[model samples]
Target: MAVTGISANRLELLSIADAVAREKNIDREIVIDAIEEAIQKGAKSRYGAHHDIRAKIDHKTGELSLTRHTTIVADDWEPEDELEEFNDSAMVRLRDALKRDPEAEIGKEYIEVLPPFEFGRVQTQMARQVVTGKVREAERANQYEEFKDRVGEIVNGTVKRVEYGNTIVDLGRGEGIMRRDQSIPREVFNVGDRVRTYIYDVRPEAKGPQVMLSRAHPGFMAKLFSQEVPEVYDGVIEIRAAARDAGSRAKMAVLSNDSSIDPVGACVGMRGSRVQAVVAELQGEKIDIIPWVDDEPTFIVNALAPAEVSKVVLDEDADRVEVVVPDDQLSLAIGRRGQNVRLASQLTGWQIDIITEAQDSERRQKEFAERTGLFQEALDVDETIAQLLVTEGFATVEDLAYVEAYEVAEIEGFDEDTAEELQTRAREFLERQATELDNKRKALGVEDGVLEIEGVTPQMAVALGEGGVKTIEDLADLATDEIRGGHEIRGGERVKLAGVLESFNLSQEAAELLILRARVAAGWIDASELPQPEPEPEPEFEDVEGEDAFAREYDDAEGEVEAVEPEGDTDEPQDA
Candidate 1:
């Protein structure tokens, strides 16, 4: 950087390059090249600006050389830039060069050694700027290359500065910023304080590569457990899933491959030392380390700790679960501000709906009463017979009408004669309902072709007619969501939109099938070309041994399962 005086000795120039290379952590050759360019620019300022000046330095002896080059060009050769005129000082015509030397040809260079001149104030300033810019660019490239591949790693750095709630950390070789939202709430750091963070993202930008850091990411918690729990780091136990509410609380599910070792007990070391280490680093944020199970219901039960679950009903198609807990355990199951259930949902990737036992009981009774009344009206049966039919899971007249006479006769107190009579009445009721629906469909101007499409029943035709889809083409043009209810963002708020066939409780797949059938009927697609439904994957079976095998045997014999007590308080995390 101190190469201002061209009169300085050649040894001093090389010494400056060596010192700069060492200070900036760059190669000596790079620094020497930058200095040579700086000297060339200074030489051009003293010599004629249009002259072709070049400078070089001896790698070993530190000697400097300045030269002016003139190249012989053909008479037809023109300048490359359209706006620029020829430079007579840098190039010579081959016709004139032949007059001076018989061997002169195009592209032949004539070099003349020049004496070095002292650097002026203006020239020294310009040369210094050029060298400084080049060095800074090199430093940025070096920093980016050193840290780009270190993403998803935990790093230690000193707090260099804080600006507007963002912490700038000096990583010794690079700098990283932890935004306000990424840092633990209420956790403050002073300058020069050592801090540990996890790198979640690293990407190149116009200014330079950015190293994004965070302490609140779910990966941060998982990484902390891997550091403290040797089983997790060694792959003996695996962290299956993790969810965090930042400084409030976090939950992670872990499983063990070796049946002899308990994952929860291993993570929660003697007297809670291992978990406490992570808790302390996280500013006393509570952690729940649930033992992960392959069964989703069992895992959800484990995730909502310190609260007992009475029953669990899952809807696999919707990826939703309805959990029923005792009246007294409702608040505990929901947690403070729904944090427990929310974290459980995140950890399990399911939408959970929690309900009390009282509510579930009331719902069951209402459904039973509704179905009993329907059977009584449709089959012309007494209240007792209708209630018995409801208890036997007879939901609709269509189901009873199509069932085998033997199945109906199997019901207690119902003989062959009673079964025959009930079946006759169910068929009559269905015929009447179909006539009414068909009349309504006709009144709505629904084409007969719409009902001709496979899977489009009379009820669906009525619904589609009311929804303004009166023809097969109209039905074929509709999206599946338009028939299977969904939410949409409107005016910055999520608004619920009712589907045309939402009352039928159609699944997404069923809705798609209906539309595909309509499209085929409309001549929009060939029936043979329709996409087939993929087969469900077979469930994996693992060989069980040790406690797992014992538990399964016990469950089979006793008709119930015993929950394993993780060796820690239910409120704290015991595993990774």
Candidate 2:
């Protein structure tokens, strides 16, 4: 056995590993891992050994051992340990240098380690290599164990260096890397910056454990909010949603079940204290907290705070929204070249088209006329009666979905031929609309949460977009008529919305209403568009005046048809 450096008595593999652990303040297992790694490296460096080799270290006590195992079947002349050539007895003390115990069975193999002896210069160099390798392996193992479970959790680390906007953090066990992409843009970082970052992941790489960290992760912002606002952690205030622009701005929607505890106020704290602290963490990022709403239009109003929405045109079939503000408030509504609307879109997941009142009004009058179901051609009595027939539920746009088109035809106001025409048109229009939607779906690459189904007029798309329904996927289930109907119900004396529904392929408003309506019908939404009905009609002459009484009643009963009926028809009050 040849040796270099200090001698280790009874230095089993485990003992050396333990000593390294105690000395380096690393785990003992790390040292064992290091030693085993080193042994394999050393055995490989030998290059000519035909025997199996192994290395191990004890856990409870520091001990290190290495051995070369030789198969008894063909115990060839190749030396089992590091040295390949067998030397004479003087050059190789086989019995003593190799600890050979008396388990003397010929066919059984033996594993032995080199005993204490002098190593030549080359051999000493080899010894240093093994120890260095073991140390490096220990460092990696230690680093891995320390940071593995910390992924996705916040960690405090000092900025060791910054290069090309990328900050390298020195987490005590090993270095953590924070790349430029992970950092909030325009936020300056310098050496010794005590930053709190979220550990996104830990991956094992060639040199050591790779610690991936991020400052812009939403979780980081959420955690900061939790720390700054005591109510957040206690569940008094809940963060329902957050939309970020990295270093520039963030919009969060919050809700508090406790009516007395205002979510926004709780976040803002006294004199803007709590929110300020969170802002400081984000390096002065602007944050807007808006209250969440059960209704989308109302929610959007809050989402785009500080701007008054004069009108919201929902494109139900397209799941988009068009919002109109007065001309004077356009910039405020858009917010610094549309930053507000942009973030609002991200927050609400919708495409919004904003217009001034004039533009909105003009669009409604001209381009969106189809939405009203009417046109330049004047409507006469027959058309009105025809519409009334439709309102009574004989509309067969999608005939398979309804019963009794014929019964509707038999009603006092309608004839069979007209009913048949109505049914056919209804069916064909539905078929056309279906084909249109299918085509739109294909063209838009319509995927859930991504592309929207087509058929939205620009104005309607804007309205629904403003309302938070952004895609055809958003509109397909909706009753396309509801949005353009503008919360108005169809059945009434002059309430015939025929011109509106039939005139514009456009609804009275815009495509956004149709888009959202479609989605509503498809059951993608939980909202309802049915209007509250008007008061019921009352029966005539419930109260009788006493003057003429039954004497007039007897005369009326006898000559009722000729005298009373004609006069009653002329005198009776009726809807104009």
TM-score of each: 0.76, 0.57
Tens-digit lDDT string for candidate 2 (158-188): 9999988779998776789888988998878
User: Of the candidates shown, which would achieve the greatest TM-score relative to the real structure?
Assistant: 1
Which pairs clash in the backbone of model 1? 287-573, 289-573
Q: What value does the lDDT take at residue 31 in candidate 2?
A: 59
Residue-level lDDT for 23 in candidate 1: 95
